[model samples]
Target chain A: KDDTKKEIMKYYWTSLHTTLANYPSLPTLHERNTLYHYVISSASLFPCGDCSIVSQKLMRKYPPQIGSRKSALTWGCKIHRKFNEEFNLTVPTCDDIAASYIIGS
Target chain B: KDDTKKEIMKYYWTSLHTTLANYPSLPTLHERNTLYHYVISSASLFPCGDCSIVSQKLMRKYPPQIGSRKSALTWGCKIHRKFNEEFNLTVPTCDDIAASYIIGS
Candidate 1:
């Protein structure tokens, strides 16, 4: 269950970053807030209770940094690493995370 | 890009359904709302603009039906099929959806 939740989180966050990159311009306020809610609500809805607890704590601590695509992607990668640390899982470097989600140049 | 968006949507929605099935009890109002936002914001954040437009229309037509796990799963499946139909993709039956996400049962 923990591993499954982790996989879901990885996919969802990667998708978010890739989506941000796919857009031609900076996200509008509405889009930024929508992305914020996606991360927060997804954390809250994590199936693993322990993982959700950790996620919620991290949500409060780091929050979501949203604005341009690159900023959002960077923020997501950083937070994902934080979650990895919290779970004691193998942590990916920021460069690796960014590379994994690259949609365009 | 369209195919990538479709695959992301498929993974995210199926994850939601599977997570619902993993939970032992009905979700609280907070949890339900969280799940709803996850779906909405995900649609809003879809990489493909055309897909996002179609997803928003679907959101308006079918607001999330939240209460129990099974209900949420059913609603997600129905909406996903609606999306499939809208996109002219292969549509999975509701039964097939439930079967795919089955946890304990």
Candidate 2:
């Protein structure tokens, strides 16, 4: 568990750096890390596309079915990761992590 | 693929909201999702606990061997989530998502 905790911490921080790097403007370490925890542990709200990072794109496709405070409580952050051992699509960074929502199970 | 994409988007955005909930503040879905992609795909740098979301907590314990820009590029985000379908720690939201780094393989 010690090792797992260490590994978990390392993975979480690095993920934040990588997440902010895409914007060409890096977010503060605290900002990124805090946000990281929020999403990971957050509940699955409504659905993914309903509250995606790129919502406009999703809205264009489906507009009528989005938004609900109750659903918000159940949403979890969705970042896709594919490692050499995990998915073999190694690229140092995941393909894309559009901020989307996940409904609770 | 279309359905997968839809699912992915929804999951990402909702995650941000959940993440922000922890701070009693909310980050835009865009902010969270962008960060999500970075951590997901970034290479694992050094090891975890080196650059954790709660770094001060880590620095107190393990000092002297943290931070290496080269390693930075390889680090991935670390968020601990146990889904009912994925793991058994199902709790609407994940356990925690610390901003730690992952040393890429």
Candidate 3:
């Protein structure tokens, strides 16, 4: 169960980062709102109860930044880093979030 | 690029299905709304532009069913099957969505 949970989390984060990395550089207001809602929904509906709670709390502390692709990607990396810190995992650098997530970049 | 997109889609769908499988049997109105928004955001912000467009179209034709775990799971499976069919891939059976996505179920 634990392993599966970990695998699921990996998938979720990878997908999210990749999506953000590919987001429009000059997104419209509606597009930003949509991405914001996606972040909130992810925090609320994530499969792991404990992780969900933690994510919601973290979101409240640092809301998603969806103004642009760079902002969104940075925000995602920050959140992911915080999550890792909370669980005592090795923290990843936020500097290369786009490079890491973007395929064939 | 194609292979990477396929891998990302696989991850996104697996995460989505697993989350739906673990959803509350009798979800609160807020929970239902959250999941609904998640579905909408997914259709809108998915990394693959073509896939996202097709998903948005399908979602408009058949809006997500978030009334309960079973409803949500079945809806997810149906959408996934439809996506596969769109690409001429073998469609999966929806009968065992919960069993398939729910790890150790």
Candidate 4:
């Protein structure tokens, strides 16, 4: 079961990576960081902070570090569970972004 | 007091209008609408659904309709206040997006 979840995170990240690859100038890390902070500062955004929807997508497709591979999955789970407090929406974990959803294109 | 609030909404719309001027290919209403629905399905996103962060930003800058100018202000507030349940974040009314935050970039 966990393996399936991890696989999904992978796909999600992969898709994000593909989308961002087209952009010649990736927003600076600072800009991204600022944006992330802005989104997460709010309770809704913050719960999803540990893992950004975009970051999870980016990492699975193009991991900056090997360690991120697992972090993507793990961190994503944390955010999903956190947000599920009320809405019961399926939380997006890092792995869900990477391999599963990020499937090439 | 209401006038001040309305003025603030006006400024927000203006800022959104400015940012949109740069987008050569604006996302179609359908596409934008899809994305908006995706984000808002959850309670967090929905509260902000009445006023999409990007839409509020877009409308204030480039209006498809004059009627939307006012909708931007009203809807934004509904979403902002809705999310304040656990996270006392300032509600982002439509006006916040159009005239205030949308100030020319």
DockQ of each: 0.51, 0.04, 0.73, 0.03
TM-score of chain B, candidates 1 onward in order = 0.76, 0.24, 0.89, 0.28
In model 4 chain B, which range of ten residues has the least summed lDDT? B38-47
Candidate 3 chain B lDDT trough over 10 residues, lowest sum: B96-105
Judged by DockQ cut-offs, the docking class of candidate 2 is incorrect
Q: Compared with the real two-chain complex, what DockQ does model 1 have? A: 0.51
lDDT of 4 by residue, B1-105 (tens): 444333333333232233232222444554344323322322222112333354444434443331232443344344344433224446555555444443232
On the 0 to 100 scale, the lDDT of residue A38 in model 1 is 84
Give the lowest summed-lDDT range of ten residues in model 3 chain A: A96-105
Query: Where does model 3 sit among the CAPRI classes?
Result: medium
Clashes of each: 0, 68, 0, 65
lDDT of 3: 0.83
Q: In terms of lDDT, which candidate is stronger, 1 or 4?
A: 1
**TM-score (C-alpha, index-matched) for candidate 2:** 0.18
Residue A36: error of model 4 in Å?
1.8
Q: Which stretches of candidate 2 lie over 4 Å from their true place?
A: A26-105, B1-105
After superposition, the stretches of candidate 4 with alpha carbons farther than 4 Å from their true spots are: A1-29, A41-74, A81-105, B1-60, B63-70, B73-105
Name the TM-score of chain A in model 3: 0.90
Estimate, for each residue in B76-100, the C-alpha lDDT of model 1 and write its tens digit.
7888799889889889898887776
DockQ leaderboard ranking:
3, 1, 2, 4
